[model samples]
Target: MKTYNKLLLLFIFLLFCEGLQAQSKPSWIWYPGDFEVWLGNKMQSRRTERGTFLPPFWKFDSHYVLIDFHKDFDLQEAEEAELYVEGQYNVKIDGKAIFGYPNRLSIPAGKHKVSLKVFSQDKVPAIFVKGKKVVSDSTWLVTYEDKEWIDQSGKASDQSGTTWLKAAQWNFDNAATPPSAYALPTVPQSPVKTEKLGKSLLVDFGRETFGFIRLHGLKGRGEVAIYYGESPEEALSIDHGETLDRLDVQFDQKKDTLTTLTKAFRYVNVQLAPGMTVDSVSMLYEYAPVKDRGSFHCSDEEINKIYDVAKYTFHLNTREFFIDGIKRDRWIWSGDAYQSFLMNYYLLYDSPTVTRTLLALRGKDPVTSHTNTIMDYTFYWFMGIQDYYLYTGDRSFVEQFYPRMKTLMDYCLSRTNKNGMLEGLAGDWVFIDWAEGLSKQGELSFEQLLFARSLETMATSAALINHQEDAVTYGEMAKKLKSAIMAKYWNKEKQALVHSSIDGKQTDNVTRYSNMFGIFFGYFNADQQQGVKKNVLLNDKVQKITTPYMRFYELEALCALGEQSYVLKEMKAYWGGMLKEGATSFWEEYDPSKKGAEHLSMYGRPFGKSLCHAWGASPLYLLGKYYLGIKPLSPAYETWEVVPELGGLKWMEGKVPTPAGEIELYCSTKEIRVKSPVGKGTLRFKSKSLPKVKGGGGLLNKGNGNYEITIIKGKDCVVKYN
Candidate 1:
C-alpha cells in the first residue's frame, strides 16, 4: 500500500509539472507593430503604422500566423530544409509541399519552436551562398523575373545538418511614444479688435502674442503688412506681401510675442489698398510654450468615436439615397477625387492625412518631375477642392488654390475644340477585357459630360465671388457645348445619345454612359429626360447595376433628377449586398452570387486592391448634400441653399461647419428645418410628396418644382423668385 501510494504521488507531480511548462512556454504573440500580416506561412508583413497590422497580399479576412522559425539556415548550401511546428500545419519549401504532419497539432498559448531546412536541386549537400540563400533576395529575384514558385512539402527537416540556425527576435514593443513638446495654445486669449484705419485694416493684438494670421477673400492686387504699436504711425512692419494673396502667414516663434519686439511699431497689421476688399481674417498666437510641434496625439477611443459618428452619418445618408451597394474595390479613386473638389477649401483644416493623400494622388509622380495625364489629375484635384471648401468653409484655401485651379481649368479649356467639345483618351488607352466588351471598340465615351459638369461648378464658383465676366464666359461655353453635344451625339430616331465617336464617327449604339452623362451634365431636354427615365432607370436588360463604377455616377444623376424611389431602391440593393458579404470597410466591388470570383480588383488585376479610406469617406458627404439638402455657395459659408429631399428615409439631421458658421439641417415626415448662425429657414408640413416652395427670397426653384432657399443678407434682396 505504501509503494502504490508513492507511485501515484509521483505520477500526479509529473502531470502538474507538464501542465505548468505548457502554460509558461513562449508561444508566438502576434506583433501588433507589424504593418503587414502574412497570409500564408511563406508570406511576410510589409508596412507598419501605429501597431496596426496590414498584409502585403491583399485578401479579405485572411488569417496569418507569426511563426518564430527559431532557426535561420542558408537555403543555397543545405541539402534539404523543412519547417516544423508543433501543430499539424502543412509545410512547404519555396511554396512546394515537402512534408505534411501525420497528426493535426493545435497551437495553444505558449512558446513553440519552428524549423526550416533548405536543400539544393541536385540533391547534393549545397554550400552556403550569402546573397543567394537570403529569402528577401530570392523574393526580389522572383518578382523581377516574373517567375513562379512550386510548393514543396514533405521534405525532411535536416537532410544534411550543416550549421545551426540563429533565433530571431519574436517579442517586440509597439507602444506609441508621446509627443516630446507641449500642445500649442489655441489662438490668444486676448480679444482681437479690428478697426478700419484709412486704406489699411488695423488689428490690435492687445497684450496677446500672435503666431499665425489667416485672411480670406482679399480681392485684386494689394500689399498687406503686419505692424505693432498703439497708433498706425508708430507701427513697424513685420511681414509684407505684394498682390492680393489672402493672408496665411505663420510668425516665427521668436517674434510671436508683442513684448519680444525690439521696436514699439512691432504690431500685426494688414493693408488692403483702395481697390481690394477683405472678407475675413483669423489671428492665431500662442500664450505659452507648446509641448509638440508636429505631432497631435488622439486616443484610439477618441479617433474611433469621430470615425463612428462620421460613418453613421454617411451610412444614414447613403441608406436614404439608396445608392448602389456594389462593394467596389478601387472605386474610391473616383469618389475621393469628387470629394476632394467639394472639400478643397478645407485641405489645410483638420485631417492632415486625408488631405495629404488626396494631394499626393493628384499631381504627377512626387518622385519624378513629369506632368500627369490632364483629366485624371485635374478631375481628382477638382473633386478634392470641392469637398474641402464644402466642409471647412475656409476661404483662404480657395484664394491660395484658385491660381492652381485656374491653371488647370485653362488647360482644360485649351483642349476644347471649335465645336465647343472636349476630347481625351479613355481608360489610359489600355484595353481590358471587361471595358473592351462594353464598348466593343475602345473609344472615349461621352464621359466628357463629367468634365462639363465640372465646368458648370467652376462657373458657379466664379459667379458666387461676383466674377460676373468669368461666370458669363463659363455659362456661355456650357450652353454652346450642350448644343454641340446634342447635334454631334444625340440620335432622335433611337431616342438616346451615342456612347462615343469611333474614328470621329458615332458608331456604338449602347446607351449606358452617354445617357448618364446627359443627366450628369444637365444637357437633357424635356422629352429626352422622360425617355432616359424609362429606358435607363426602369430598364431590365442590365440585371440591376450592381457594379460600383456605374452606380456612383447613376446615383449622382438620380439625385440631380430628384428621383427618390429609384435611388432608394438601388441604394438598398447595393448596400445590402456589401453588408451580406462580410465587409468591415467598403469594398471595391460586390459579387451578389457569392461565387469564388475575386472581390477586390484594380482595373481587373489581382494586385489592384486599395482599401481606400478616402473613397469610403465620400458617401457621407454626398448623402449630406443630396439627401439632407445642405449646400454651400462659397467657402465663407455666408450664403447657403436649403433644399431637402429625404427620399425614403425616416428622419435625418446633420451639421456641416461652413466658413460663415455651422449649418444645421434636419428633416422628418412632417417638416424640414434649416438653421444657420445668421438666421433660420423652415419648410413646414412636409409629406411623402415633394414640398412646393413659393417665394423669391434667396432661393431658386428647380425644374422638379422643388424650392431652393439661399440666405444672403444685405447685398442681395431677401427673396428673389426665379
Candidate 2:
C-alpha cells in the first residue's frame, strides 16, 4: 500500500507540472499578413477631398474573408478554454462540432485538435484561444480556403489540398481586445491659440498634427464645416483645402462632436451655421505606440533639432505601414516606404512593422502594375527586403515571401527590352525623380542599376530559402545586368554614367542618379569612383537633387565615400533650412530659392505640399549607420563593427539596435567607449598614438596609426586614443 501511494503521488506531481507547462503565454493570432492587408485598405480609404471620399487611383486588393485556424494539443487533464474571435466563428474539437460558438469549451485530456472557422468582410479573421495547453499564437496553422470536400455519403475527400501558414500576431495580448476593435492609442490635445471671427473660429494646434477633430460643448442644431490645413492659409481656403469635415447637427443638449475619420493638419478653420455653436475645439491625437530605441545627440543644436523633428516626422508617417505623407497620398509608395524601412532600423527597429509593410506592398501579386505604379518603386521594394534581411536577419520572413519576390522580379524581367534593358512600357511609370524636363524616353541607367540590385536581393533571398538553382540564376542575371550597365552607360569622356541609352547609343545627359549609386554599389573601380565623385556627384553642372527621396541616396553615397563632413554641412543647410522657417516637421520638399508662400506650394496648388513626409527623415538613418558607424557584417548581427566617424561633431553618443540588443557607443577625439548586449564586435579607429585601454583590455595596436579591438557580448570596452 505504501509503494502504491508513492507512485500515485509521483503521477499527480507530474500531471501538475505538465498542466503548468501547457498554459504558456497566450496571444491573439490571425492568418499571417492578412491583418495588414485588411487594415491597410481601411486606412487608405479614409482619405477625403473637400468632404468627398477619395480612394487610391491604383488597384487595391482585399484580405480573404473566410479563414480556418487550428492547432493540436495534448493535455494531462480535461481543460476548459475560452474563445474570443473578431467575427462570426464556429468551434470544433477533433472533428466534432460544438453545439454553437461556445464561450468556453471542454477540451479533453487526450490529444485533440481545436479548430475555428471565421468570416469577416471588413475586418481580419482573428481569434484568441486561452486554455491549459491550448493557446492561440503564431504556432497555430491557418488556411484561407480549407478545400475540405465531402461526398453524398458524408466522407471527406482524401485529395483535398490546402496550404496552411503559421498565424501572424502583434501585441494584442488581451482576451477582451479583438482585431476589429483595433485603433491606435489616442491622447487629448488642445489648441495653442484660437481666433474668433463672428460665427467662424481659426485654431492653430501649434504644429503639424494628425487625428480626429473634436468640437467641445457643441449644442445648437445646424451645420458646422471644418477645414483642415498643414498651413494657416490652407485652412482659410475653404474652396481649395484638401481635406474637410461637415456635420449636420440636431443636438438638444451639450455634447462633444468628433470627426469620424482622422485628418492631418496643424490649423483648422471652423465655420458654423447661423444656429450651430461650439464652446471650444480640440483633438484626439492618434499615434503609433512605438518605443524610440535609437538616438543621437551632438554639439550642433541645429543638427540635434533637425534629428528630433525628423524623428517626429518619421513616427507620424509610420502608422499601419510607412505612408507617403499624412495629408496627401496617404498611401504606401514603395520608394517612400523603402526609405522609411531604413530609418526605422535606426529608430524603432520594429521588425513586425517592416514585415507588414513589405507584405502589404507586395499584396496578392498577379503582377498587374508596378508597386505604386512606378517602375523604380517595384525595385525599391526588393531592395528594401535586402536591407531588411541584412539588418534583422530574419530568414522566416524571406522564406514566407520568397515566392512573391520571384513573381515581382519575373514581371520586371519580362518588361525588359530585347537587349535586356528596362525602357518605358504601356501603363508603366518610370518615376526616377520629380525633376522637371527629365526624360523617360529610352532605356534608363537608373532603372538598370536598381534592377541589378533587386536581382542581387532575389539571389540572397533564394539562397536563404535553399533554392540553389534559382539563386544561381538570379546571381548570373545580376552579374550580367551589372556588366551591361557599366558597358552601356559609362561615358569615358564624361567620366560618369550617362542617364539613358537610345538605340544602343549612350545619351550625353549625365545624371547623378546612376553615378552616385554606382559609387556605393562598388560598380566603379577606385579610380572610376573618384572620377564619378568629382565629375557627377560634386559637379554643379549635374542637376542637383531637390527631393528628399533622391537626396537620401545621394547623401548615402557621399557618406560611403567618407564625405560625412561635407554631407553634415549639406544636412544642416538643407534640413536646417527648413528648421529656420518655423517647420514643426520636415516638408515633403524644400528649395531655398523658393520664397515665402512658394515654399508651401507643390503639384500646382498653393498648398499642395505635405509639411511632414517619411523620406524627409533620412537623417535618422544617416546619423546611425554612417556617423555612429555601427553596421552588421554577418547575418543577425553575429559579427558586426563599430567605426565611429565624428563628422566634425565635438562629441557624439547613440545606440544602434540589433536582434540581439543595442550596440551603444560614445566617441570623441580623445576616447571611445563601447558596449554590446550581444554579438562579437570589432572596434576600428584611427589614433594619433597607441591607444590605452580601460575596463577590459584587448586593444591591438596595428601599424600606421590604426588600432583594433574586439568586443564580446555583455561587456564594456573603453579605449583612450589620439
Candidate 3:
C-alpha cells in the first residue's frame, strides 16, 4: 500500500513538470531551411507600389513540397505522445505503419525508431510531438527527399543517397502557432490628430510607422481611398504618393474593416465616396518583437538622440528579415543587411534573426545569379556569413550550410573573365552604391576588393568546418586576388586605388569605395592606409559619398582607423543633419546640401527616397564599436578587448551583447568601470599617471602611458587614473 502511494505521488510530480515544460517550450520540428524559405517568400511579397503588386525581379525559390522526420529514443517505461502536424502525414514506429493518422501513439518500454513523412504544397511540412521524454526538437533528424525505394519483397530499402540533417526549429513552441502561421506582432494605435476637408479626412500618426489602417463603422457603396506618405505633403499629393489603398464596401449596417496590407507612412489622406462614413480611424502598428539587449547612453544629448533614432530606424527595418527600407523594397538586400547584421550584434543580439536572414538570402541551391543579381551584393553575402560566425560562434550553422556556400562561391568562380578576374557581365550588376555615373564599364577596384574579402571569408569558413583542402584553395585564391587588386588598381600618384581598370590599364579616377573598405578590411599596409586616408577619405577633392549606404562603410573605415573623434563629428553633421530636418527616422539618402522638399526627392520622383533605411542606422554600430571601443578579438568574445576613447565626450557608457552575455562599461576622464559576462578581456586605456585598479590584478605598462589589465568574467573592474 505504501509503495502504491509513493508511485502515485512520483507520477503526479513528473506529470506536473512535463506540463510546465510543454506550456513553456515549443516542440515543433521541420526540415532545416524550408521554413525560412517559405517565410521569406511570404514577407518579401508584402511590397506594393501605389496600388500595384510589386514582387522581387530576382529568381525567388520555394520550400520543399515534402519532407521526412524521424528520431530514435530509448524509454525506461511505456509512454504516450501526442502528435500534431501542419500537413498530411504518415507515422511509422519501428518500420510498422500506424493506422489512419493516429494522434496519439503508445510506445512499449524499449529502444525504437519513430518516423513521420509529411506532404504540403502551400506550406512547409512540420510536426510536433509532446511527451515527457520524447519531445520533438532539433535533436530529430529530417530530410526533404528521402531518396529511398522498396524492392519487390516490400522489406528491402536503399537509402545510400539520403542525407539527414538536424531539424530546424525557432520559437515555435506552440503547436497552434506553426511556422506557417508566423507573423509580426501588432498593437492598436490611434492617430494624434485628424482634419476633415470636403468628405476627405487627413490623419497624422505623429511619426513614420508601418501598419494596417482600420476604418471604423464603415458604411459605403463606393470606393474608399487611402494615400500614405512619410511626410504630410506627400499624403496630400494624391497621384504622386508612393503607396495607396482602395477598398469597395457595400453594407447597409456599420462594419469595421482593416486594410489587408501594411504601409509605411506618417500621414494618411482618406477620400471617401458620397454617403460613405467612418466614425474614426485607427491603425494596427506592426513591428518585430526583438529585445534591445544592447544599449547606449552618454554625455551628449544630440548624439544620444541620434543613437535612439538610429535604433528605432534599425528596429523598423528589422522585420521578418533585415529589409532595405520600410518605405520601399522591403526585401533583403545583402549590402543593407550586412550593416544591419553588425548593428544587430551591438543592439538586439538576436542570433536567430541573423541566421534566418542569412538563410533566406542564400535560399536553395542552383546559384542562378549573384545574390540580388548584383556582383558586390553577392560578395556581401559571404562576408555576412563570416561576421555571423565571428559574432555567434555557432559551428552547426556553418556545417549545415557549407555546401550552399560552396555552390554560391562556385557560381562566382564560373563567371571569371579570361584573366581569372570578374568584371561587369551582361546580367551582373556591379552596384557599388547608388552614386550617379559610377563606372561599371571595366574591372572595378571595389568589386575585386569585395571578391577578395569573400574569398577570405570562404577560407575561414572552410577551416571552421574542417574542409581543409577547400580552405587552402580559397586561401590561395584570396592571396592571388589581393596581389592582383594592388597591382591593377593602386596608383601612387593618386595615392588611392583607381576606380576602374579600362582594358587592362588603370583609370585615373579614384573613389572612396575601395579605399575606405581597405582601411577596415586591413588590405592596406601602414603607408598605404595613411596615403589613402589623406587622398581619398578625408580629401575634399574626392567625390564624397552621398548615400548613407556607402557612408556606413566609409564611416566604419574611419572608426576602425581610430578616427572616432572625426567620425563622431561627421556622424553628428550627417545624421544630425537629418535630425535637424525633423526626420523621425533616418533616410535612405541624406545630402545636407539639399534643402526643404528636395530631401524628399530621389530617382526623379517627388517622394522616391526611403525615409527609413537599414544602413542609415549605422551609428548604432559606430558608437558601440568605436566610441565604446569594445569588440571581440576572437569568435563569440572568447577573447575580447576594451580600448575606450573619449571621442570629445565628457563621459560615455554602454553595453554590448555577446553570445554568452553582455559586456558592460562606464568611462570618464579620471575613471573607468568594466564588467563582462564572458571570458579573458584585456582593458587598455591611456592614463597620465600610474592607474589604480579594483576587481582586477596588476596593470602592465605598454609604454607611452598606455596600460593593460586583465578582466575576469562576472567581476566589475574599476580604474582610477590621472
**Highest TM-score scorer:** 3
Q: Model 1 over residues 441-530: C-alpha lDDT tens digits?
A: 433445456566666656766765667887788778766666666776777765677667766687746456668657755688778877
In model 3, state the lDDT of residue 87. Answer: 89
Query: Which pairs in model 2 have colliding backbones?
Result: none
lDDT of 3 by residue, 545-601 (tens): 899999989988888777888988998899999999999999999999899999999
Highest lDDT model number: 3
Off by over 4 Å in 2: 1-20, 149-161, 701-703
Candidates sorted by lDDT, descending order?
3, 2, 1
What's the lDDT for all of these models? Answer: 0.41, 0.88, 0.90
By TM-score, rank the candidates, best first: 3, 2, 1
lDDT of predicted model 3: 0.90
Q: List the RMSD of every prediction in angstroms.
A: 31.9, 3.0, 3.6
User: Cα miss at 545, model 3 (Å)?
Assistant: 0.8
